[model samples]
Target: MERKVCAAAVQFNIELGEVEANLQKALAGIRRVREKDARLVVLPEMWSSGYAYKRLAALAEETPRVLEILKGLTAEKNMVTVGSLPEKVDGRIYNTAFVVDNGRIAGRYRKLHLFSTMGEDRFLAAGDAALVVSTSVGRLGVAICYDLRFPELFRKLALEGAEILCVPAEWPKPRQEHWRTLLRARAIENQLFVAAANCCGIQGKLDFFGMSLLISPRGEILAEGGETETELSALFNFEEMTSYRSQIRCYQDRRPEIYGTLP
Candidate 1:
């Protein structure tokens, strides 16, 4: 049996350091998509607390209010949601993405590669592990903004049976080309779906390019957004992805022994 479902990526304008306001905006976006009966929804990184780290430590939430809200939303709407926020855990802060499925916390993936250019390395602790969570939709691999630049991470997830890679980003306008190209390349090379949710508006001096996208296994853009607050949705057929993978046979032809010796 082939499984197919509609998924959405939400793009919004995040106000810096305003946790409550940001939460409200994110909730509204989720509700708007639920009205259209989207089962899987993704939000950009730092949607709860905008990516201004100087004030992020003060704005960060130590409580699980964000998680609780997501749990309730997913349960009420019968949807799965993926979003990232500043997490204060045991006195350290992490850029963490939470997977809320059917009113429960499915898993959390912290940003493994911190953006040194933005001083993320100084403010947040980089995550040590890659994460893939199974859901009714499919096995989803979660990654944050800069993680898209690392193809190795996506490759590892695809090899581990990930059917979809959900990237929650706060990508800027200056590198919009890199954002689009990297996302398509990841999907094409890994032969899986890539759903990226990015933000709009500005945080300090950095202006975000809100080009949220949904891509197929063969590097096809299923849905895409522009530089505005919007939601992009697309239907994905797992059977088609499987058929494409079988035809390409890229995974089966891997010469792991030689490649593994490089590092």
Candidate 2:
């Protein structure tokens, strides 16, 4: 793994069901961040198509093309990126995050936690598996949107040797604190780096607050985006994380036998 790496998060308003426009915006963000020498990039959840639940199946058809373009871009730049998109398989739709590394598909993590309040469970099928995969940058653990609310998943990722957690989200307003706090807590407790991307602006009736964040193991915010379209970048040091883990000893002190074993 690289001792230090530059990571970036891309934030933008997603046009409902507009694949081409969203693709262009995401590509532009990636280009800008790459110029800053970012080796890894994370884009917002369901970027190619917003929560167009009625047309999710139709919109998912364009995901393969979007992935192909991303493959070409990562291959040319020799970088890795992650973002969630609608995936259609066997007539069922899933909110899946694709981790592209140097032109190849590294891994795909489906959204395990669906926002039932928004009727997400009605439209999308839930994922049963978690993803932590090796990439050109380092060991990456991937989760999407509502998964941030579940600390157990993050703990599992950390225990499985994930160096960085990449989260792609479309979180809305009136809950920005929850978004920020949970992300930092996940990093501090797990003692790893976090790069989370969230979209901004309005999509239908929902208003997204784009506070994309890059957090260190000590829970320090490295880079943060405002409530608009933007890109945030920061340098993450593996040595720093290792040192913090040694100092805190959160992992060593854990008594899973009493709390219940992680499945």
> Which of the numbered candidates is closest to the native, going by highest TM-score?
2
TM-score of each: 0.97, 0.98
The CA lDDT at 59 in model 1 is 68
**Whole-structure CA lDDT of model 1:** 0.90
Q: After superposition, how far is residue 121 of candidate 1 from its true place, in Å?
A: 0.6
Candidate 1 lDDT, 40-148, residue by residue in tens: 8999998988877777777676328878888898988899999898888787899999989999989899999999998889989989999999987779999999999
- The positional error of residue 205 in candidate 2, measured at the CA in angstroms, is 0.6
Q: CA lDDT of each candidate?
A: 0.90, 0.95
Give me candidate 1's TM-score against the actual structure.
Answer: 0.97
Each candidate's number of clashing pairs is: 0, 0
Off by over 4 Å in 1: none
- What digit string (tens of lDDT, one per residue) describes model 2 on residues 40-135? 999999999999999999999999999999999999998999999999999899999999999999999999999999999999999999999999
Q: What is residue 246's positional error in candidate 2, in angstroms?
A: 0.9
